[model samples]
Target: METSDLAALTDRARRLGADGRRRVLGIAGAPGAGKSTLAARITEGLQGRAVLVPMDGFHLAGAELERLGRADRKGAPDTFDAAGYVALLRRLRHPEGQEPVYAPAFDRALEEPVAGSVRVPADVPLVVTEGNYLLLDEGPWAPVRGLLDEAWFLDADPGLRVSRLVERHVRFGKPRPYAERWVAGSDERNARLVERHRARADLVVRLG
Candidate 1:
């Protein structure tokens, strides 16, 4: 992520948002491949012209996951409200009225989705969304790719990505050993799924 590359990406985003309608730029990557970081950087670079709408915000609540027996595979594609996410994306594409549209946000500390936590003003031109499944083409997630004006897939060394995932889990309150196990199990599976769809993206970003 050099300064030059960041500047170019920001400039590209600005151009995409220049059209009359809102433009969506999606950042897709495997777990710990730095999707969120890149999305944040783009938003910051755009100043007030862009707003972030993370896909993680649409994660099924822990209680709902437990009820569906999906608590163990929390980060899996099936564990999200895919339809709801798609609906939100549609609303963002065709904003109604003059009011800002509110989107959900995920709270890492509480491990829950907070409703209406992010507001995307109608006047904002660019909406940056990052997630593991943005490029996924199966089931309900299929519509996601069509909605985005541009999609970027982040590529990183597998070992470094796993290491980052382990650290992230630990930072979020999981015991070190448990985090390692989760990374090896659930996270690894999700990572593979995300990688499988890398070719579908408009661009592949090397995040070494």
Candidate 2:
């Protein structure tokens, strides 16, 4: 979490995109391991050379989840639009004279995806994407690993991560007891799934 570490990551991002082709950097971690925060910091440090397209944007709609009987495990791997996410990544990788590729953004307030909310310009050299399942090797998630130039896994103390997740759920309007129970149940399951693929990452970053 040092400034120098972020600087190094920024430099690495720059180099990955130096060959005149767009580079995708993926940040993967457990539910509350701070992948999104690290991705934002790295993109900010890169100045304007990078854009962020988060995996959360591909979260399936509430209605869709309910229809599929997955509403109880909304954050699980199967609850995402994995194929759509892969297709978007493919498009981002080879823009080829097309206009800026618009990506979806997740709206936490409404718990839905807003289409075309993020614009990735043709000239942007880097795309930083963060999510829990980037390193997952099962089903539709397996292809995600090959699309990224570099993948980083963020790790943190289990108790601290669980606390952060609980607070986040509370901030998003869940009651304290419900939030704690959800984290101990659904989020913990997803966290373990993510952890199983940690060794596949190019870098494993331990955050305080």
Cα RMSD (Å) between model 2 and the true structure? 1.9
lDDT of each residue in 133-179, candidate 1, tens digit only: 99988899999999999998888889999999999989999999999
TM-score of 1: 0.96
Instruction: Assess candidate 1 and give its lDDT.
Output: 0.92
All models, RMSD in angstroms: 1.9, 1.9
Report the error of model 2 at residue 191, Å.
Answer: 0.4
| C-alpha lDDT of all candidate models, in order | 0.92, 0.91
Tens-place lDDT per residue, model 2, 138-174, is 8999999999988988988899999999999999999
Model 2 whole-model lDDT (C-alpha atoms): 0.91
Residue 146 of model 1: what lDDT? 98
List the candidates' TM-scores in order.
0.96, 0.96
